[model samples]
Target: MRRLRPVRGKERRKKPIHDGCFEIRNPARLLVVAPRVPCPVKSEHISDAVASVIGPDFTIAFQPIVDLELREVFAHEALVRGLHGEGAYEVLGKVQAHHRFAFHEACRVKSIEMASMLGMRSRLSLNVAPNDIAGPAECFHTAIRTAERVGFPVDRLMFELTEGEPVADLPALAATFRSFQRFGFTSAIDDFGAAYAGFELLAAFQPDVVKLDVSFVRDIHLSAVRFTIVKGFVAICDELRIQVIAEGVEAPEEVDVLRRLGVRLFQGFLFARPGTAVLPEVAWDAA
Candidate 1:
């Protein structure tokens, strides 16, 4: 794992491209927030405020990513939920702008802690924001320390760059990926072909994995255009030595079409719904 370096006095004032507030969206819904400056409060003060707001109200659910060829779970994605099992949107909706940074940090720490407690042996995939990596290194250190404390191997961890917003600094993001790679951590672009995480992102930096957006995998067998586009994407990823994982595959026909397109890793309802604090079992027969 990469060692976390302390920020020097000169380093504290340097500004990055993602210094302002940004919105993050998902396929299900769009979360719109006004653009704001970085939180001006002291780190410890904001941390206390965030802890009070987030508290122990959030928990993680594991959704398995299955490998068709191996007929086993390739990884388990950790999804955030409320302590009482409310959806991610409900849990995250309460987070104020100033609390976003600490909220993200808490999610990382909690996810790793829960996954470790669940005795998860498969690679654990966690959602991450580009800004999180591009910003301070504290979040990364917190995750690394939590993993080490819980005895989870850092190499088995994968960070999925969520395609919730446009990346303001591609070069910085790419550099962050390279740095993580040097530490035995894998990088992936989530929701590929969606929003800004398209061909441009691939050209800038080829992640270890590319998860095709749910749009591409939805009823693909019924649409030749979708198939062709997906085929082209698969071919491109193949040439780049990047593994492609088809997301939101809910039908057998979709699986067949994706398999023919060379997508071996899969994640969606066709396999299993996310298990609360446990690794969900895959439904092989469904595929």
Candidate 2:
């Protein structure tokens, strides 16, 4: 494991991009809100098993989310990486059905631990497979215990339902998200425009945040159709009062168009590349 430099400065809570937007940062130092608990997930043992089952080579990375208007970091999304800092696909491809659940649980614990070690004060976004956790109360409980063990507040966690994996049961997923919300955890529909149950999921369950898929954001400034679609999507989110973040943004032109269409939060190479075990600060440019 790579040792990270001690993060300097206190975490501070800033004004939110929109009312009801639950973005928070604490102006405090490394606070062991509580001593480590015996994580109910038994993540340690499971991680060892998972590594053996898959390949003993995997880790986590973080990519910063920027508040375009403020030109500051809003949150850091926890991503999976290979042991050698290879791409996510390389790490994720090693997962098999037999150990997928264990890998998922272990990833959760690792992300929390790494974030806490780095003194991350803002919300930590974690990805989850909706199908794997569709109906497990134990899964949720274990996650809560894991956070408590690391002193990471449940309120500062955002669970993103990835679009890559298609969910079989919408009702079950919605119920799970509701349960998380009840426990002070926020939900997000990631890869919004390109996923299964795209519009249907929105109608059934309104996530606190919606990340526009890369397909829509790619070369958007040059395409009137993409612009129109994104603009309409932004309008609907505004009415529904859901925050939107444009992901995979790589060009200045794309950022310009997205900002004009009421998008204030963005995540992509344009702001900062994903960092392994390190929190990369945002290099602001006029947006």
Candidate 3:
């Protein structure tokens, strides 16, 4: 495996967040100025100053998304970690409200740059907030530019819609999905059956993939209700031509239940944990 390059400047000064465009000072030079106005979905925005502060403080981690039927890795989801190997919660706690947009953008750029450096050939799935997709033009440009700069193929990228915040406009969000699809990038509704990513979201837009939340996967073999629910999801997704990925799976029993339920993709501890700067090896026999 190739070693990741060290982040430059161990100690850096923090810059105040700004509403308008500002200059970013980081090693990758991937961030650009923010728009003069705030994002339509949210009042706060991510400026260049925020990018400068958050960019270097974080690094990318890769967690394998296994394909059981194919018996190979389908994708490596890019998770954010601290520059010095801190947990995501610890690193994300430092981000203030104003830093949301810039932090999100920084994660995307960093993920692509690191994935390229690591010579990742599988799809790179990125977690995206509803607000980010609500205003897809800016985010799209940044992703396209970063992919070009790092020589990563655009078609291999996947955007997983996170449900941290509820999407107020389904029509607009659906339109955004179409915009991304036009560019050859696939989309996924993450944490299905939980939060705002329920059946309503599925009706609004049929993403290329749907990740069944841990709640649905946990103890599925023991609980008849869970089994029936997951089976229903798999059946529906199959009809819609949407791939189902059972995430947060941790037991062989769970895998047996999921496979019987027609789930071909799996992610969680049973496979491998997220490698801080490396791709963790998958335990193929576990499945």
The best candidate in terms of lDDT: 3
CA-lDDT, candidates in order: 0.71, 0.71, 0.73
Put the candidates in lDDT order, highest first.
3, 2, 1
- For model 3, how does the per-residue alpha-carbon lDDT over 1-287 read when each residue is reduced to its tens digit? 11111234532323312321112232221111111221111112234675566745677788888877767677889887876788877887888867777788878877887777666767788988887664556657666667767787665678899987889778888887866665556688899988888998899888888999999999998999999888887889889888899999999999998998788889999999987545677888976
User: How does model 2 fare in lDDT?
Assistant: 0.71
What is the Cα root-mean-square deviation between model 2 and the actual structure? 8.8
Deviating ranges (above 4 Å) for candidate 1: 1-50, 135-139
For model 2, state the Cα shift of residue 73 in Å: 2.3
Query: What digit string (tens of lDDT, one per residue) describes model 1 on residues 41-111?
Result: 11222246557867767777778888777676667888988767799888888888777767987787777
After superposing candidate 2 on the true structure, give the runs of residues whose Cα lies further than 4 Å from its correct spot: 1-48
Q: Tell me the tens digit of each residue's lDDT in model 2 across 163-225.
A: 877778888888878766654456788899785838988988887788899999999999999
